[model samples]
Target: MDINRVSARNVHQAHYELIVIGSGFGSTFFLDEALKHITGRALVIEWGDYQPWAWQVEAQSNSPIAPESTYKNSGNKPWNTTIALGGGTNCWYAQTPRLHPNDFKTRALYGVGHDWPLGYDDLEPYYCRAEQIMSISGDPDIGKVLPRSQPYPQPPHKGTSVDALMKAAMPDHHFICPTARPRMATANRSACCANARCSQCPVNAKFTAENGFPSLFSHPKVDVCLKSEVRTLEYSGNQISGATIASEGGEYKVFGDVFVLGANAIQSPAILLRSDIDYGQTGRGLHEQVGANVEVFLEGLKSLDGSTITTGYNYYFADGDFRRNRASCLVSFENRWWPFGLRKERGRWDEMLSLSVVVEDLPNPDNRVTIDPQSGQAVVDYRGESSYAKAGIEHVFDNLDKLLAPLPVESINSRIWRPTESHVQGTLRMGIKDDGSVIDQNMLHHRMRNLVVVGTSSFPSCSPAAPSLTAAALSIRAAELLYS
Candidate 1:
């Protein structure tokens, strides 16, 4: 597993068996799987420079917000993402929950959004593979809401004292959250020290693409180019011939047998739109989860002493008969101290607790990303269909007292707003029909045989669960299809 790292200026061999854009979970997982089957060379082009965890920790330590550039959005809602080597995994909190079985058949069951071309059973094996690679630790039995064929690689990470208290208070609700962070030292990475800054794990304990799948970069079959931005796909008829890439030196076309777009929800569609290949479905069905934050003063109770950020989950409201009318939500207990800027007394600050409620938003085709004709920037015209989400939020607020009855509650501040657009999905969605979807069940473009799109963009619908694990699983499945 020794990869050939090359600069755009030195790349004499332009042809590759596979060309994957972006080094995130979408492309990296696919590269790891594709390397085993394909003997031919594969190229992974990343737009951003490689930033190690050590460097990120030092750079983002003092700042409340991490240093990162975002894609322009005319709608004022910015996409919260990172373009580094590991992509969003470098900045994510690593809460990996498999989508519930019902999530795949949302159209059939709820009669709202389009159903996924493939079902949960189709992705279960790949999910296991991704979990093993990521060293996911969690109580498999606790994920009863989402059935799985196999157990997790490791047992659930130990919850903080506050989590225990919450569990004790709400015995009926499941509180454990499946996470990618290692419970104990394994591989070369250290165990989670509960530093409460998972966004920039100083010890590299979190399973980012760089640490989790090092072989993808080190493999002899793979050649990764950093700071190479793939501008557009060069297509002849029904196949993508090459990719026009913009590097620091100059623009160059890199030919490949097959091209995969793993550049995330925003950039992926932007690339497709820029290529002038209108599938009629590109940049459509854009949506994100409806998120609300509940700040409370836990009298005499101490919090923010746990591992990184999230510690517990209340899945009581994730799904139910309520899906017929509105979206369902999952409540997460935040284990990080608030009032991020000002210095606070350690003893007094421990009394603060934050509860995050994430409600599922139905995919609306009208709420989409369109490239500005003049500026050439991706403009997200997202008018959220939040009535359903609002209903769900109201339900959560009504049950707050009942859920936290056993615990001491002093003051509560509940605020609901549109999500930070972190979990972008449904732009280049996957479905059974070519007329409705950008890609098919295999994530291959409907019109272009050699073009495949991966990542959250291929998600038919956004569920309440965090989408990274599912995205990784989908990427692996697509890789298997491509190699076979």
Candidate 2:
């Protein structure tokens, strides 16, 4: 199969009903809904070539093109993403958890960051739709914390001994991790083997754009152009007129009645900035939780028996009165066994557990993405992580031992700081007005009515959870609200 296929056709360039800028969760999920109802032509512009799952596995990389070349930055913080046809879907671990209800109302409930213009209920139905499309495996009991409309398409994954202990102790807060990794073998993929190289799943068990939404791209109404990077958007009055695209052949334009920017937090805003369409805090409020890794050494207990890598979560620390003062945290119990996962002692080889403390940070307008004048690529100035998140990590490091007091006695290792969460967000923030936001609650550009900006770029808050599910849900809702 040709890995780098580009359709030379003008895309019927004269007119397209919709022109989407990325093939990530935001674009694909939106097309999933739009194709079902809208009868017009849709064009997807992907910056990277379509490398199949088999090719990706054989290559041992998501893309032949490196992610670093897509942007220019001098900051020490690493920006992680796959710049390919499926975007981050090719490399993400697929830990699909919906944001807690309070995550929508940070200002109202926790008296901190701005609340989301839309709430959990607004996206709840679309969340179910996205989860169904991805065949998400999750514990239904998680509905206790975040309300659900339907049962998960797949059953909950098995838990490790550590997960079992935590759940037995805190039934209300601890639950099987909601994931896009299949629990059982499905027609499209096999069950997860738990090797933990989830970035590039060796067994092809995780939900990727290749397996999960294959039909969405191939739909008769949709047309895709691979290795075409959109540099800027052109608009007049209050509508998006066209986009300047850089492709293998040369630079060109693609015209559409509606445009959706799904090129992630950094690139999306950079595209807008390059177009000279800066407004509504175009490249501001960039934020994401940079959390800590907590490795627990157990005495007699053994772990790593789960069906998936991450088995369960302790949400007790994820939300509480402490959120008012410190960032909220979602603690994930990693059910992974490896050479590094083992205890050094011969007798206690399996007596170890790994936990990831993911914290929620308030948006800092100072941390943002801008277009570098020299290269015209994304320049992410993102050093402004909140003290709220830092305090949240400290809280976990200080009290995790006590929280695990019910379990076997052992050493709780020092918290190791992470360089990046791999989730970039809030660059093109959404709000009720156009002054301090790019898009509205419905994902529509506040001033450019026909232009919709989807994905984490429109996120108002940086929740600790992975952004894929919420991104998918928002896209689906955007299509539904616009077309239906």
lDDT of 2 at 169: 88
RMSD of each: 3.0, 1.8
lDDT of 2 by residue, 92-158 (tens): 9989999999999988897998788999999899899899888999999999999998999999999
1-484 per-residue lDDT for model 1 (tens digits): 2446788766644899989898777888887888889879888898877776667889873223332333555566656767767788888888988888888887788776778889989999999999998988876656566677788887777666667877776655665678888887787678887776788887888888778876668777788888788878889899999888888879888899988899888889988998997795899888878787787777787767665467788877877667878887888887765433212557676777788888888888888878778756677787865687778888888888876766678767555554473888889999866558989999899989899898898998878788999999998999998778
Lowest lDDT block of 10, candidate 1: 61-70
Candidate 2 weakest lDDT stretch, 10 residues: 1-10
Where in model 1 is the C-alpha error above 4 Å? 1-3, 61-70, 165-172, 299-308, 339-352, 416-421
Query: Model 1, residue 306: displacement in angstroms?
Result: 3.9
Give me the runs in candidate 2 sitting further than 4 Å from their true place.
1-9, 337-340
TM-score of each: 0.92, 0.96
